[model samples]
Target: MHKLWNRIPPLASDYSGVCSILFELNSLNILYTPSGCVHPIVEVDEIRNFDNVFFYKSNLSDIDVIMGVDDKFLAEAELLVLNNPNLEFISIIGTPVSNITNVDFQKIAEELERKTKIPVIIFNTNGFESYNVGIYEGLLMLAKGLSKEAVRNPKHINVIGYSTIALGYKYHLNELVKVLENIGLKVTFFASDGCIKSITEAAKAAVNFVISPEGVGAAEYFKEKFHIPYFMDIPVGLNGISRVLKLLGTHLNVDLSEIEESIVTRTELRGINEYINKNVLIIGEPLTSIGIRECLRADFVINNITIITNLNSTKKSREIYKEDLFSQVIFVEDEEHVAKYISQADIIIADPLYTIFIRKEDNKIFIPLPHIGLSGREFAKMEYEYVGKMGFEYFKKFLKSEV
Candidate 1:
């Protein structure tokens, strides 16, 4: 029987790429999903090597938050902060009950901070908002707390929106640091892969360039609070990097050599892209799904793009991306269906659950998790050699073998 405390049904996308990303970035074991949605989270944990992830029934009865009012959450925060004191930043996410009860998260956090000397911020994640909004807001809250520190140096530039996961962050951060430093921009700060010191010095940066929608709010907060200019857009692949260079050129009043390098790199990727087989069915998070699908389909034909996700509170991906661009699109809720469709596809780019389903089969290939931004494409291609040197190599290989 479903637990009484669990409220909402699990999102179909819960078990794969999106779940993996959240685990890698947030350092969370159990997501605070409603009890009814248990299966999706369970399924997501089935395939991946996620060690720090677990699920909690967040459907706190109205009585619990309003009347019973246990200090569980506040205590949990204090414990986490104490353990990770460098956690100068703390973000609190509220479930439906906490939202409706009008629980004073700020007050609770401030009280905890007063006693423990740690900063805690609150982000409301009730039904009104989607994960896209939740992630951005969470980032903003984290940035706001961080803005309190004095500037250490003007060369400090923060990487907003890339991520907190181990998958792509390792490669992306290294490349980004090299690109910015090569262009004479002193590196300031980076998130996900950033240290506590850099985060503490966030207010000191001259400007902020946000690469993901999730990073946009933090960029804006830094801009408004510190008089630092923030640029919001993707900074991956060739075109995305060019866009960043263009914006930086305008801000710093100088020509950007990064633009030249980005163009050359993109041209090289495009040449490699031509050799890739096109037929594919991509299953992952929306941002990664759309970005990868859009890039791959630019000059090649993508047979179909399927999003396997559990973020049911958000609209299906078919509505997220323009429908006219794809040959077919579907939002799947069942793993059995996902496996069946993948079996027929030439290539598959998805999380480990899907990967394990296809791993033993000679028909499909796995593309790994956290495939976001244009940069992920090149990373996938060159690093994995299955997509475009940086984009969709396994899918390409699968298609070649299938045809």
Candidate 2:
């Protein structure tokens, strides 16, 4: 009853997040559930489902649940591996049905690996938790299973924890790759950007750029195993990217302040003085909302920024760029509480769906920032830039600061 909401749909579940991560890999993904469970993932959250990845749902019947039948699952997985010799690995994702029935996903994965002789990654993602949790688990598994122990390169860096579900990968990350390359840092791997080699050799990078909370687990794993260091911030806007380069250069004991500034920067402004002293509240995933806040405060026009986020990983992380800079922070658990905060803002920067809490008649301004976790396919098909110099320009549209 506490989780029930009248207008807003539930955010993408853990399995969807796990599936989004697996969607990028060259492996067969088996989501264990009853019938009709995979629709929301393919139809909504996963906008780039090309029907090429071996994605299947284990149609566990009522009797199978009662009997704990796993032989059929093993046989199906073995057959798939036998047929697809090019498969790199396999992913076993769980749903609410498996969670309630006390399914031992580890045992199932062990058996499947023995039968297929290929590595099997398991995400016991019951549908109850949010998608970022599943993504966090999936990426950590990839870090442990696929990334190899290799010699590190000082000029190489990997963009960790970004997923396709964010819906800004094509425009945002592609530009980011070019920017990092131009700065003399080779982007060795970008997680879940559909590069299998990037994932496998992720350890070779001298450092990792952890852009989201989903990458925390994998970043920590690499830090512990391969002794790779990481920073938790995306080079968002023009000023933001320069600050990020400085941060990276500091970590490697190199100076990038001497490097030419980004081509993009804060504009003279079409009209932002009205929002200068306004109380701005940014609602979205942790890293994203924080990046927006960083962008807004770069010129010091909007200092009163509040962040509402879903993941717990960012707050606990060290060396996160200006994590304590926010005026306030709220962990999203209850809808009513979120609405109460939404009503208090002079301006709100969040997905369009969140605007439902605020009436049009109200004087409050709503900045439409699309998050895949909030609206799924509603914004997936649309164009939204949330990375690099162009991303800041896209964000600048709502701020009325485009020059």
Candidate 3:
């Protein structure tokens, strides 16, 4: 018998991913699903605060589903376009119904674009895949659809795979931008956050920074199409931050000596040995989990470290944890397995959703590091203030308060 899922909620679906990529853009987002599917994005996702995003729901009823709703989709899309002259673009996102009915949204999107005289992109995201897959696909389509040929600017860079749902995303990006600017580099565009005009000018950037693993595919596209060099790293903690600065300086041949000196002076303000003997568990997507592990291990001489995630293991991911830093590296699917690890660890650093699996009686210190896939927008307000010296200071404060 299939075990019932009463303890843990389902992970965010491909539909959520499609919506996330389009969240900040000044475009019309239409979800072709039953009315119920809309609740997850509207109620659970972070875009609730973004009033600028134009969203619509095509509530396919049982009869409409059986008869098929191609004409209905065309009619509604045309009407929306007619009504909203200010609309920059339109995205048609599919749910499980599209998969079941075998609807070809790509062809429909082409037709709609022709009919409306407006750019229409379709993401037939069946609920079968996880959020990461959806995010990768959506961003890839966006990059291909929007980025145009232009003269490359050697000092400008684009940050790809950036999502509004990430914890402290704005603050962290601002911090990184300051450092980049200090070295005479500019952030030309944030792939997901900027306007369509900015996205179209993406090829102008001299380099691309793939901040999340979700953005790797998009960065690869930029490299091949525009020949823009890309860097794949999410610089967390002081050491990681230093490495990022040095690597970028070396690549661009910039004088980052002043920034390096500032970083050195800041390091003396905090000691790394304070976390000695503390048992810490890092859990989330592979890229994020690895980042946290590097940061925590660098500053604190923790007695035990455990990294847990459900992301597929690749050669690179395996190489990251090949060292003897983690006592155990767990790739778990079910909540029971995750709960087992939570029970053993003294401190749990994971998405808020995992907290549901933890036993109430256990005095485990829960530090919420929100992941879009796990908790949607529940903790969207929380900033991931864990980058550079400020990030190190944040950890020190957190350790003191919790441990």
Candidate 4:
């Protein structure tokens, strides 16, 4: 047996990732697994609010797994497509059972597509990989299957990689859109909010703004196929927002003088400078951790930072911003590893699941930020603002009051 406890729970599984992307589009999403496999995604994640999107779960019984029930799976999919004539697309997501049985989900998807004349996408997510991998694969499949060649519009852009798993993502994206619009840029489509039609129209946009690292695959696909360049940055916090706007301005050759002035004024008005002495520990996906770190360092001068993430540190994430704020960057898989670092921090910013590992005697401040992989949407009802000047203000307020 291992000496240390494996405290770190599995981050959002691959199926969650496929569901996150599919939930945004106008498609009928079906999880090919037993009844229990669908609960975590449906009850805990953000799909609870997506009443318009159709989602179904297949009944894979004991005999089905032992004896192979490909016929049952195909018939169920056929029935759904026949009943819902207006359905744009069908996505079949795999679970642990399907993976173990070596089920040929792709072949079944092809068969379904041929029979119903409806486009079908399959993700063989066996719950072994994390959400980031799932999101990358899901987005790549969407781009490859749906994007078509078209004339480009210099003024339009498609924002990619805004997922439901991000805490307060809707508010963050809305603010980012407002800032872009202020600079006279049109957001043709938000990749996370579009369907097959949106993916087809992506070729018309001049650029793809990859807000998260997960969207990089989709952005690269557009670049090679449509000759569209991408700007990789999630504009969070005051400094984070300013940096993104400046980059956007340079690329588009637009004057963001007014926007810059407004951002500086807003930061000053928020009085974020008062909390410079605070120390923070950030843990999450790579881009999110980086964005929050940049924001905290720039606005509040919280330089005593430590970043713990599931992604590799060498893959351009550490070098994204020239100014380094992280004192230590730890890539972790075990709970004991996370515990060693958490013991030294005064403020902990992470998913709610990490709270269980913290010692009761340790006097530390915790700000609950929900992550789909960690706590899912259990605490999504509690709003945590972490984008734009106003988001920074909310962050400052959170620290001042919570600590």
Candidate 5:
């Protein structure tokens, strides 16, 4: 089998991504597939405890699947709304079953919206693609459905595309907020908290800081509709943090010299004053890999860095990384492609599950940087630093022990 793997598994599909994006938002999110399809996420990828009523699995039966019964789904939706009447919107996320059945998700979504008099967003995230596409379309649907006409708040900002599972927890927002608040700019809205208020307040932000590829669609929407200036970047390394600050300061017209100097001061306090020259490989989604690659180069002074990932960035995301000459992004076609890079790397930093691709006897340094999308909650340490200043510091801890 071309897709069979000895150890590594396939990334979570699109419906999971869409669900993760909507996980924290105050909306009625339903997966339109057999009940079993929701298991991969609810038991593993999702950190939300049970008893949460907003999210549901449509519980399609053998007859419903055979007949393609839209009425069965609508009846369930009507009951959910009847119980949770204060919902701002409803989202119908699709999975592999829907794709195989060739269901008309859009028509059903239109019918649902018309019947309920609330916004119904069809994510169209059939299980064909990986989670990034889900996150991308999920946020895009969110922007399309929720963003409103409002006067812009000059110092206000929204951190889009940063959700649990793929990007770690919303505490990453706290790290960035600490940075933004120091420079007289504040994060007015962060969507990862599962707060519906963030969705409503999105239109007023002066800038939308896109943290992952998933947010690209939503950021573009804000720019086009609200005329808000947004740039795509994840705060990872020391320089990566500075780069984001520079992007934000330019838009908000604030001074960041004090903040930049303080980051250096804190980094120096960590006693990291060495240029670590080694062949290193970073793997995972483009969002995480790209951030770690940039962090390694600018912070560790490692020039021989290379990245391998299964996910590719948007055209605009590539442009964002074009100026990053320190490393290159390789899209892995198969396990062999990954084997080739890990074979060359003296050190590897990625999700722990990628260990399946490497040799156990090799004298290579493998640092555990667990991504929730890859390893689920088994390995991802939410407080262990995955973004911004704290992210770099956490990475530096690995350098101290392994490098």
Candidate 6:
């Protein structure tokens, strides 16, 4: 029954891993339960050098879970906010214990906010749902808060769904800003590490880019209430950028060819197409998993693409790439198990989880194919950002290798 329920959940939570991504994106200052393990600490430490981070400890006990969020912890949070004059907000993430207790987190946050005169955002992080659900819920919470403080600014567009958890988010955003500015469009918000003032100006943008489905609800809200136009599923690849520019053209009533030439066309697709015929395993967010699957097929005779995605979050991407292309596309729930399968494949494209174990002797080429939407050119930008000047050094090696 336990096994059945584990598989039955539409989107099981992997909180430890997801929170690390959230932290990498600089979206929140996560508080840890005393009993929590080292995963968050490790991931947070990895990304800490890239951004500002602060942590707080909450010594939650089993007794507290059975009863509710200990009043003492809430009081501690309030005290911490009061002591830190520079603090802007506090996020209360739900732990497994808290979920089991069915604590009224919203009430606790409201009380904390009222007490500290600081914003308290409650996010459910029970490791029972997929990361996308957590991201979407977190964004919704952010939107609700921003809505109250939103300022009307016309001609700016909010870029939602590209969180800091993604590799090379800074580089990608900078490039995007330049591309949009070249076309005379102003970027209003980044949705990740984005300034509060800028986010409040979201209503000011002429159109919003629903870069990921996580932003779908926010985009719909703005369109319905503020009459802003929205373009959904604009990812980080050369062709993906082209699709975005075309959408912008339609919205602005301008020509798209020039924009495409300047951004997508000038860039080269990494010659990985020649090796696409080799059996490859893909694991990451659905947008990335599915987008790469289609993009690679254009160049390689993609044998199979084993996916590690929660179906609910990847519905849109799934609709784009049916089960026909791959010899088989399996939905994975465990990272370790998936990694073992990846070890058997000719090539592997994924985030750090899968890449951490690959060896030179295995003859399995590993590409840092994060699902953040970089095509050939955008990926180059990422390689430069995190890996320093050696950017693409590893990826390029993969491209040159024969499957």
lDDT of 2 at 8: 73
After superposing candidate 3 on the true structure, give the runs of residues whose Cα lies further than 4 Å from its correct spot: 1-5, 166-169, 255-257, 269-274, 311-329, 356-364, 401-403
Estimate candidate 5's alpha-carbon lDDT, on a 0 to 1 scale: 0.75
Candidate 4: where are CA atoms >4 Å away? 1-8, 167-169, 266-278, 310-328, 359-361, 399-403
> 267 in model 1: Cα distance from truth in Å?
6.7
lDDT of 5 by residue, 218-315 (tens): 88888888888888888786777788888877888877777787764444432234426678888876767778887877776676778777653444
C-alpha TM-score for every candidate = 0.59, 0.90, 0.87, 0.88, 0.90, 0.71
Give a tens-digit lDDT track for model 4, residues 367-399.
666676566766666667677876677677766
C-alpha lDDT values of all predictions: 0.49, 0.75, 0.72, 0.73, 0.75, 0.55
Which window of 10 residues has the lowest lDDT sum in candidate 2?
312-321
Candidate that beats the other on lDDT, 2 or 3, i.e. the better one: 2
**Best of the two (1, 4) by lDDT:** 4
lDDT of 2: 0.75
Task: Please report the TM-score between candidate 2 and the true structure.
Answer: 0.90
Task: Look at candidate 6 and tell me the lDDT of residue 29.
Answer: 53
RMSD of each: 8.1, 3.3, 3.9, 4.0, 3.3, 6.6
Stretches off by above 4 angstroms in model 1 are 1-102, 126-131, 149-155, 164-169, 188-194, 235-243, 257-259, 262-283, 286-348, 352-403
Error of 3 at 319 (Å): 16
lDDT of 2 by residue, 1-403 (tens): 2455667777788789888877767888888887667888877887675567888888668788778888887887788788888888888888887888888888989998888788888878888777777777778888887888888889889887777665445555777788678878877555565777788888888888887767878888989988989888876666567777777888888866656354444564533676788888888776777777777777435788889854332332223323464335566656787798888899897888887789887789887767787688686656667666677777666666423
Work out candidate 5's RMSD over C-alphas.
3.3
